[model samples]
Target: MGGRAFSLNTPPIRHDVYLRLVSKFTTLLQTLHEIVRVAPHAPEKITHGDIDVLVASPLRTYTSEEPIALLGAEQCIPGFPTANFAIYEPEIEAYVQLDMRICPPEKIEWEIFYRSYGDLWNILGIMGKRVGISVNQAGVRVSVEHIEKKNKKAAMVHLTDDPRSAVEFFGCDWEKYERGFGTIQEMFDFCAGCRFLDVEISQRREKITVESRRLRDLRPLCQRWFDEYLPKLMGEEAGREIELNVHSREGVLEEALGKFDKRLDHDMLVGMWGKDLFDKEMWRRIRALLPLGTKRGNIVVRALAKRLEEADLGNGEYGALCESEEWRREREANWTEIAKAEWRVILAAVQ
Candidate 1:
């Protein structure tokens, strides 16, 4: 769902223009025998601002070479298998923001299942929360503890891998999610059938005033999706009773901090103390302990930073965190304000 945003003044492109851009990239990937599929965005829209594509190859790893070759260097936004870029459309004579997610051949089906769902995926994520199941790009985990035990890596469960268990757990139609829909209209119908839109609307109306601005942006998008798009697709209003309990923000933070403590204790027991080399995994573990923009997570981050500074990892990756300008810049860009402040304090003390 994360991608590069274009200039504020950028105009949206017509549906045909969007298709042309999709076709251009599809052809380029065909040469490399990589399978490509465009996500079913609002096909009925007059104009689109972005394109999302799923690319899969037999190769275990993917580089940005193919996308860079087609879209050019200036357009590419750096990332791992998931790359963001902008392509110039000859027909529209404008640039279209494109997000390309590269998946391993074996995991392509699950990737397609997740990527095509769009907001529906967010709805499923909410369902996941109710049942203590965590769903993300990697796959689904039963709990935050399970994720930490695996070092926060997705265990890679395919959709077909006992999906019925998940559906039954959430009390939804297993067949619908499995088979999906033939058309975008059918997909909208599926959303209505689940009464997800109704619950979403109710939740938004109730929480909009209290939620952060970042969360409020979705309100308009949800309104347009249902109020405008749904009625046009379904002809009638959709509503149903949803039996899910909502947890308070404080409760969520407490659960996250508890999980962080467990992970920290595990690391300490495994001798990840001061002797281990500082690497990307260590950096990720520290960042993971600090959930973005959360005071509690920032507290944990500060504690981890102090602990790391007191330890000795020789002249390993720890030095880069303080001395390397590039590393500092990247960390600052990715970290939240409180986290950046904590990290800077740690670096100052160590120096």
Candidate 2:
């Protein structure tokens, strides 16, 4: 609306083709926004009749089948969608798909392929890790090995297969191994530097944990509590009593319980407790022993804030990618209010 005009073309699109086209277009636009850090300005738009795509004027046109061509267009590009696995161009940072016929969500193989690519790259990028690549007649082979500490032993490990597999093997119970090379962050770092063995491998390895150690450690604690303590507390004696335990002194537990009660009060009044039913007394006691101000709360809040800030509020300003400098500036015009609102919601939950 600001500088671009949208146009629609009335052409008959098969139902299947239309769905694929719409999905691809969305991903393309999102990727561009992320890469350019600017909103996309479509001055000329073109779309066949009744299609979901909204193009701006000067009228750029391309078929839904031609994903590469669609992605390369200057004004319009695809962006991320809620449920599709696709690649992003390094230059524009926009999401792209080479084949709409291949539904990423439905095709488990394709999903596996894309996810694996993202995973491999992440694992090879740790601080002293070197991901070595060699080209052979068969295919490309990439490998990473490093010395890591486990139970007071420095052991060398090999991760020479697909990144997705490495992540699965190493990060499955990451808290147990992340003190060394077992983390999604290591996986992401590996992905950022290494090329995919195939397209499938890259997509599977999309997300990595940079500071995963904290969560990794906490994961075991939660698991142990759920598996061992829950039953013991219930007096049903399930698993064998292990030497490892969480500090559960009555005084500390009582203090934790008190804090939990305060937070629960805030949460219930603000409607944050709808997701789960927690015992007020138990939570207060747990809060006493647990680190109260960990960044876990902030992480959840920031994630929600970022999502809301980028969401379209139906202000008739659709098609503008917020990552663009221009769009961000415009958003910043009212961004503070939105941010404050999100902060309030998150703070209430974490309290």
Candidate 3:
């Protein structure tokens, strides 16, 4: 497991304990730079699994080495422009995951907006998608045409630049868009007023089963947003409709899975299981099985493994899958041809 993995039975950090740790970390970060923003901002009273900080400076780049040296980080996982460090907190008596994202001063505002409010951003993203406005780490853009055609470069367009457009489209306050909310109540009020709240709730619930651990932690906030706050903001009738739709969708997915299982024969079942295992763990095994020879062969295998990992399928499964004789045989049988095809494609691209 990576540095952040904890047993499912791990207890939540008390709010007071969390604040003390954050205050200590913030003090240390402030000594490094003046422009540091901690996430889950201002008035949201909730338990956090990790602390996320955005550090911006005029400098071109920042590395994890500084933080590793300063904080005595147990592990540093390099993420190119952004890095994650596991630092021990004496108060909590456990390792706390800290994600430090270093960016140029110009991008600080957008970075803060992107990282601060997780559930709020998710809800806003749903609304943005409905109306063809895409909001991402890069920036908010109405369409792909906003992207530079030649280099495919794009800068994040500020929401404040055209606040009225978003306000009209999403029915949120322009003031809140410019200045971040001071309390969770403000966030609830803004989302509660949005016409797209139902859609946002539906999408959030749909992702509950499939979301990664980090995203899963936001479920409580989202649930409160829909189950309690929205109903009060809207009418009880609208709240009931939202709940009904969520239940309906869950039932439908469960029914489909049951039917699919019934239709799968023994070989089909094994194939499905194998496919799932392959998607998760096959790439590393493939790399391990690659025959040692030319530098190009090693490069191709590494590149393929990197690509699969980027796709969220490189690792994190039971090792027993890799030990299967059938899987090993199949992988070995196809590896030569796969490597040849990959090399040919690389050559074609270069030529």
Candidate 4:
């Protein structure tokens, strides 16, 4: 379940200074209305009491006369000083209603306009060093202050449509969305690679899972190493030195995870274990055979491996390979160590 934020009008006006200011605001509105003209047929309302203003709703605050659809807070800014009485478009209906009830019965000859609150922290329930202001009628502007919150741009991004809606949807806190999205993307990438390791027929699943997770979480240097540099290196004996190359990448792995890493980092763990493993040249040739711009590497490899794994073999004691308990154990242990070593190297390079 989510929680909603409190508005300044939430009873028990917490600050003494704010309470006093609000108390005087009502008187200020009365004085302004006395000097302004009253409209004929307008109700003769007293300007000495509290008036409710619509704070948030679907209607325009200044110009529209539509019936209120969604109810927000009832404002209490009575007697608030106005050089001239002006109502904003979306909020005009509610403002007019309250004015008719609380202001002098005489119509106040004045104009109506809108002004967006520049203090995003005050509206969005969070503080940031940078802030943005945009008006439906006006354009956009940004502000940065060292003593303010740092995620101001992010807050404005959320408020692209309606600042009020953004604040409400994200629980009146921009950092909540920021932190939530960060965790979501990280888990998404890590789990995607780890899902592949879960298919193994060996006891190396745990180690593979951890390494795959790390590779997915790579940052800065590590990202370049595993995605761009590692895939270009030839076999260990070929002595190909690894260096970042943005253009080099395997099509299959690159397709799914390319935007993240140039190629799938986990694939290298598999290639490192076997003598007959696909090398850089073999990978390139395979990629060339693929349709231009195709990136589905895992699907291609799995399809090939599935077909090959099902091949019929001549009846013989080939089962002897599995008969040796020592051989089975050795295969698992060796591959596990090799995977861990490759993962460590990748981690080191990234760090």
- Most lDDT-accurate candidate: 3
Using lDDT as the measure, what is the rank order of every candidate, best first?
A: 3, 1, 2, 4
List CA RMSD, all candidates: 13.7, 24.0, 15.7, 27.3
Against the reference, the lDDT scores of all candidates come to 0.52, 0.32, 0.56, 0.28
How much is the lDDT of residue 149 in candidate 3? 31
Q: After superposition, how far is residue 254 of candidate 1 from its true place, in Å?
A: 22
With candidate 4 superimposed using the best TM-score fit, by how many Å does residue 193's alpha carbon deviate from the native? 31
Deviating ranges (above 4 Å) for candidate 4 = 1-49, 52-126, 130-141, 144-165, 168-351
TM-score for each candidate, following the candidate numbering: 0.51, 0.18, 0.50, 0.15
TM-score comparison, 1 vs 4, better candidate: 1
- Misplaced by over 4 Å in model 1 are 1-10, 58-66, 71-74, 144-169, 174-189, 192-216, 219-221, 224-351
**Candidate with better lDDT, 1 vs 3:** 3
lDDT of 3 at 58: 25
Error of 1 at 10 (Å): 4.8
Candidate 1 on 156-262: residue-level lDDT in tens? 22222233443443446777866766555655455554422234444355543333233335644444554566445434433333332344333443443354343
What digit string (tens of lDDT, one per residue) describes model 3 on residues 125-237?
65454333445665554322222232223311223323344354455776775676767788777765554445334435654333322343556666566556655655545
